[model samples]
Structure formats: C-alpha cells, structure tokens
Target chain A: MTDPVVKATALRKCYGDLCAVDGVDFEIGRGECFGLLGPNGAGKTTTVKMLTCALPVTGGDLTVEGLSVKEDPRAIKYLLGVCPQEVNLDPDFSVVKNLVVYSRYYDIPRAEAEKRAAELIARFHLHDKLERPVEDLSGGMKKRLLLARALINRPRLLVLDEPTTGLDPQSRRQIWQEVRDMKKNGLTTLLTTHYIEEAELLCDRLVIMDNGRIIEQGTPRQLIEKHLPGGGNLEDVFLKLTGKHLRDE
Target chain B: MNNSLAGSLSYRAWYMWRRNVDVSLVTWKTNVLPPLLEPVLYILAFGFGLGAYVQQISYAGRAWDYLAFMAPGMVAVGVMFHSVFDTMYGAFVRLRYQKTFDALITTPLSPEDILAGEILSGATKGLFAGAAILLVVTLFGLAQYPSSLLILPLSALAGLLFASFGLYFAALAPYIDNLNLPVFLFINPMFLFSGTFFPLDGLPAWVRLLAELLPLTHLVNITRAATLGLLSPSLGWDLLYLVLLTPAVAWLAIAKMKARLIK
Candidate 1:
C-alpha cells in the first residue's frame, strides 16, 4: 500500500537464545484494520510491544509514520495509542480522571484534555459514571474506558492487543462496534487476537502467527478461500495451518 | 532505544509525579493523620513521660532538655519513613500489582521518568510528613526560629536521598514481601541509632562510626542543629554528604528500574 501507516521488515525479538518474534514482515495502510491472529506464545503480543515501543527491537526495521522504532520511539509514541491486553486502569482514578491523567502523558493541555475527556466520556456512554472509580466499573465499562483513554491523544494509529479477550458477548459486540466506528473515522488500527470471529469481523487484511512467525497473510476471505476451496470459515484455515494441538501444552 | 543515561529522562517525569499527587489528594484524610499525630504521640510517651525521669542530655556542647534534643530527630525520621515507605511499598504496588508502569511505558514516558517521578513524589511525601512534625514540635516549643525554617527545605532533600535508597531496593526486590528485609535490616536500625532518640556521645566508637555512615544520622545532625539554632561549620560535612549522595542514589535507582522495566 502507498504510504502505509505501519511497516515491519524482517522484525525480530530475542530473549537470550529464545527468539520470540522471528523476522516477521507486514504493512498496514492508513485507516485499515489489520489483525495478527495467534494462539498463546505465538509472539503476537511481543510484536505489539515492539510496535508500541515497550520492548526494544532485537533486529530488523519497524517504522510508524516513517519514524524508526529504535531511533524515535518517544516521537512515535506521541502519534500512537495502545490498549494493552491486561486491565491496567488506574484503580485510584475516577472514570473521567483516568482519561484526563492519561492525556497528560501526551502533553495535552489541561483545558483541552478536559474537553476531549468530556466528549469521549459521553461517546463511550460513561458520562453517568464520570465520578465512579475505575475499580467500581463493570468489566465492560472498564474496557470502554480504556478505549476512550487510548483515543484521548487523538492518535493516528491505534493498537489493540486482545481488546475483547474476556468480555461478555454483549460487551464484546459493543467494543467491536466502537472499533468499526474508529476505522470509519480513518484511524489505522493494528489488532491482535486469537478469536476467529473477532478477526473475521474487524480485519480488512490479516496474518496468522505461530511459533514466532507469520505463517499466512491475506484478507480474511482470501485466506479462507485459499486454504479451503470447498466453502469454509477462517477458523478452519487457522486450524489447518497451525494444527489442533493446544499451544499451552 | 535511547538507553543512554541522559536520554532516559525528560520533563515528562513531572507527569508521573502529578499522577501520584492526584492519588494522594484523593486519600488526603488518611495521608495527613500519621505525620500529624506520630510526633505528638512520641513526645507524650517518650519526651514527657520518659523525659520526666531522665536528666537533661548533654548535646551540641551544652545541657538540653530531652524533648528538645529528640524533637528534631523526629522530623528527620519522618522524612526518612515517608520517603522510603512511599517509594518502596507504594511504588512496588504500582509496578507489580497495578501494572501502572507497563501502561506508562506505552506512552511518551520512559522508564526513568516513572522512577524519577516516584522519587520526586516520595520526597514530596517526606516533605509533607516532615513539615507536619515540624509544626507539632513548634507548638510544643521545641523548635527555634530562623534556623528552624531551614528544616522545611532540608526535609525535601532528605526525602530525595531516602526515596532513591528505597526505590533502588524496590527494584531489587523479587516480591513485595522482600521489601520487609530492608525495613527490618536497614530502616529500623537507622531509625533507632541515627542519633534520633538520644545523643551518640556515650555509644561505642564503632557504633558512632557506623552511625556516621548511615544517611539518617547526618540528616538528624543537621536537623537537630537547625532546630536548636545551633548551626555550625561542622554541619557542612553533613550537608555535603546529602548533596553528593542524593543524585548518585537517584541515578542508580532510575538505572536499576530501567533495567527491570525495559525488556
């Protein structure tokens, strides 16, 4: 794609002798939702961590908006937002305060942060729970608040690592809808998940990773059609390529 | 990855400090009580009760009331306890249980910023506790004016010193329980033997020499000197020690935390 929002070329991460992400390559165009589908220990989170500048890259090149991850991580962070896999909301902060405090990390001014926080609160349907501490919020509310906080900086690229990993169906659907809306608003997103349906619904193009490498990369339909000529879903393609053995064993 | 020492820190560190202050403000009621009451309780039990029986202790080359002698040391201890405990228990909770540092790393904040902020916040906590105890002592007529005013700023410096010391240990601690080792082994000894409750004059030479090595002893020396309006040229060594030690410890703390946080 011309002027991709994110580009990874032979990206690698190693911990001593154990290489977590073994030279993967992909590109995400602006406003497109890209997915990294994998089982546990598949290096999806490791790749996401590198993209978000949480971990140093061991080898190869990765860039966000033409800024190298190694050379300008701080500058790249200013242009991106990340929703981590874990529920790490500040337990001490109220729903509104959480957004406002996160905004400060981006050097967003107080007045503008408050204004944007108000808008996000209303949009996420958290206006009524503005004063409620994050610990008091339901799991779904917390997830929504995390999404809202990620958008507080008006990021050009949004990274969601298992955004709906443990949500109820209704909450999961709500998050999916919000993500779709973000895409329609032209926000480029890189998402990682093991859920087949979540990937099928959200990703415009995708990659399936296993054992530190991307085994397949294509649109959801193309991947399924290529793997199963006789009509089958993406899950069948995933199982066919990655096998049925439980990764955790 | 900008792993160099200077590149790891930036003005963004203040944001982390601001976040802690926000949390502290929310818990102000509970946070304010310990500093305010600890001195009074100590004075009532030790100063009034114990001092009633003991004769005036000779310190700074003159006879002084036991309460007067002990009061400034309480301020020093307050600085140490507040700064150390906040960075140790409070920062460890944020680092491990809360995963606050993980979230912060995704933002513009480098790991050093988070550690710097914790140290600064801990020092601020130290200042708060020290100032509270100072107020209590002043009300009891224990603090002398002018020179006593210096204690407010000195508390922050002492706070920075102890906070860095605490964060370094926090970074080394494998689990929250491991933090108890420092408290039991180091903090408790410093609290009792840092010339806080009594003069170091009659102690063994080795014990006095060891006390001179503990950061708290110097803090207490300067604080007691200031509170009694007895500042002397000898206190320059104490001031120099704190000044030189704080940044070294703070840099080491930040480096240790960076190694732990950054993979």
Candidate 2:
C-alpha cells in the first residue's frame, strides 16, 4: 500500500470540561477514500476541524503529508481543500464572482482564476446561473458549487464534512458521480458521513467511531463479515458496533 | 505564520479586501451615494445653517469662519463614523449571519490575515466618506488652504484608528444587540465630545481632559489644522498621538479578533 497521506495518534480535543475527541488513532493512505463514520456528537466534526486547522488539537500527533498539524498548519492548509458541513457561500456574490474571489486567496492570477472558475462552473452545470446571486441557487446547486470551490486550488486531498446531507437522491447521485470522476483522476478524499450507502459506495476503508474512539475498522466487506456474520451492509455493521440508531442532528 | 507583528500580515490580505471591494462595487449605486450625501447634509445643517447665526468665532487665538472651522471636524467625523460602522456592523454580519469568516479560515488565509483585511477594508470605506466631505467643503468654499489636500491622508489615519476600535469591540460582543452598548456609550460619546460640531476650548476642564484622551480628539485636531492651514503647538503632538496609538490598537484588534475567529 502507498504511504498514508494522513496519520493521527492519540488525537484529542477538549472544550473546557468536555472532551469532544479523545484518544483516536487512524491513518488515511494516499489516493484512498477513507470514511469516518459516527453518530451525532461522536466527535466527527471536531476531528475534521482539527485536520483542517480550523481548531487546534488539544493533544495528539496529527500529520498531513509528513508535516505536523501542530507545527505547520499553514503549510498543511495549502495541500488540502475543504467542503464544510454547512453551506457557507458568499450570499452577496454571483456564482462566478464567488469562485473568482476565492481563487484570489491562493494568489491565482486574474486570467488563470477566470479560466479555472469558468471550467468549474461548466463542470458543475452552473453555466445558466453564472450571474445569479448565491442565494438564488437551489440546495443542490449550492452543494455542487461548494464541491467545485473545494477543487479550485487543485488540491491533492479533499476533506468533505457530511457532503451530501439533506440533498435529494438525484442531487446526491450527481455529487457521487463527481466524486467518482475525481477519484478516477487520482484524488484522495476524507469523507465523514452517517450515510451507509455513501460510505459503502465510495470509501475503500473506514473506521466506525463512538464516544471519540474508533470501535472497528476495515473494508466495508471486512466489517460486515467481522461484525455482522449472517448478512448486512455498513448500516447493519454500524448498528452492531454502536448499538444506537443514527439520527440526523 | 508566527505570532510576531510582521508575520501576521500577508499579501493574501489584499485578496480579502478585494472581496469586500468587489461586493461593494456591485452595490456601488446604493453605497456610494449615502456616504457622499450624508456629509453634505451635515455641512448644510451645521456649516451653512448654523454658521449664518454664529458668524465669526475666535478659535486658538485667531478669528476664523465658523463654516471653515466646523467643516474639517465633519471630515474627521465622517471617517470615524464610516470606519466604525464598517468594522462593527459590517464585520459582524459576515462573522455571525453570513459565516464568511468561517469560509475564509478554511483556506490558506490565517485569522490574522482576515482581521488585517477587515481593517484595510474598513479604512478604505472611511477614506471614501472622508473624501466625500472634503469635496463638499471645497465646493462650498470652506477650505482655504492648499494644506486641505492633507485631509485625505489624515482621514485615512483616522479611519485605521476607529476601525481598530470597532474590531476590538466586535471581538467582545456576543450578539447583534450587544453591539448597541459600544455604539451608544463609546462611539456616541466620542462623536459628541470630539469637537465635531463646536469648539472644545469652552468645554469644562475635566471634559477637555476627557476629550484629550479620546482618539478622535487627536484626529479632529490634526484634520482641522491640516485644512485651515493653522498650525497649533499641539499639531506635532496630535500627529504623534495618532501615529503611536494606531498600531497599538491595531495589534489589539487583530489579537482579539483572532481569538474570536480561530476558537
């Protein structure tokens, strides 16, 4: 197997008296779609935030591309692209302007930013609404734009937090198809979700998490065979591991 | 980036400022007119309307036109008002309601860069407002000195100072309603007592001492001196006061905002 792109040892995050993430360990290999499966308050978002440098790790050794998150968060940020769980697009800007302005943070030249923005807009099927404000877009369109934006810097690793949550099946499939296409082009993804089907369809290997700890891990098929002996999928395995139904938060 | 002063600043901050500018340009028709006209209205009411009855006034041992005296103070007021609102309300909307800062933090941009960009953008708005007042005063023939051109740079400095104050207060504010405390208690007091509408000489001794401590008082002094071509003994002190206080407040603003934005 290729070297891991991300490695964590005893990862932890504490909020005053509450320990949101506690002593979790995992490794995500290069070019692999690694799923972090958990129920609400399982510290999924906190772990992701730590990885993205949005929050400092309280205690742990977490590294991306051999650079420590604690020591070099700014450098790690350049190698990764993030699609947050919430829709945080600029409401005042148009579809085109939103992408164009975002590219500037990377110091992308004007001509290059324009070209890449157009390409992503076309790829995401935002051609018709290039001039329309972000508030005008449908739920699915905004998610697609978020995906397109995450790819603007041509990052090697993509971090998606509940990427397809609340989307209609059609929109979900559209995103799935895009993820598949990007994976085929050798993209690495770290996805967190409660969706069993999404995890099964996309992730090569995953770890089931509960109470800030990894309970079980392996390929989807391995997890099924190891946990649910008779017959089942990731959802059945999740239930067997956590013993609680996963509900939307 | 390191926590040092130079390390906190980045060229990427210009991009953040550019984002605000781009959005501002889209609403230019609506945004441009208010800053331009509000000062003119203030000029008409205070400079022209009040000046007719007040006639000449003795300011700093010299007799001067009341309109000319008040005009520069209005310019300083516009810069302070615009910068404070931009950093306080405008920054708040992006921070809480819009979640723009959250989106920005995910990128290569650091919290310091975001705060710096905000400071720059707020200052730009203040400069715009100050320039508008300068134009009105010039057309109204209240500006007599070639030194009036210095008002633009002076207002820019005033803009930076007030913007820092706004951002610092925003860091401590919990909700939209909480912002009212600073606006009323801090900003309003500065606006009324900074000699924007009247001479500070006649105010009580304690009041003058209190005004001397406010940042706007120094800014108003420099602005009036620059516009009227009358150099006070305190002009050097005024410039030095603003120059030193600006960076100190700016550093505090950035550190405070970083705490709020970075978690």
Interface RMSD of 1: 0.7
Q: Model 2 chain B, poorest ten-residue lDDT window?
A: B1-10
- After TM-score superposition, the amount by which residue B143's alpha carbon in candidate 1 deviates from its true location, in angstroms, is 0.5
Question: Could you estimate the TM-score for every candidate?
Answer: 0.98, 0.96
Model 2 pairs whose backbones collide: none
Candidate topping lDDT = 1
DockQ-derived CAPRI band for the predicted complex in model 2: medium
- The Cα RMSD of model 2 versus the native structure comes to 1.8
Residue B185 alpha-carbon offset, candidate 2, angstroms: 0.7
Per-residue lDDT for B1-263 in model 1, tens only?
Answer: 88887877899999999999999998778875765577678878889898998759999789998988898988999899999989998889999999999999999998888889999999999999899899989999989999999999999999999999999989999999999999999999999999999899889999999999999999999999999999999999999999999999999998898888877
Q: State the lDDT at B37 in candidate 1.
A: 79
Counted clashes in each candidate structure? 0, 0
lDDT of 2 at B132: 84
Alpha carbon lDDT of residue B202, candidate 1?
A: 88
Kindly provide the TM-score of model 2 when superposed on the true structure, using C-alpha atoms. 0.96
Candidate 1 scores a C-alpha RMSD against the true structure in Å of 1.2
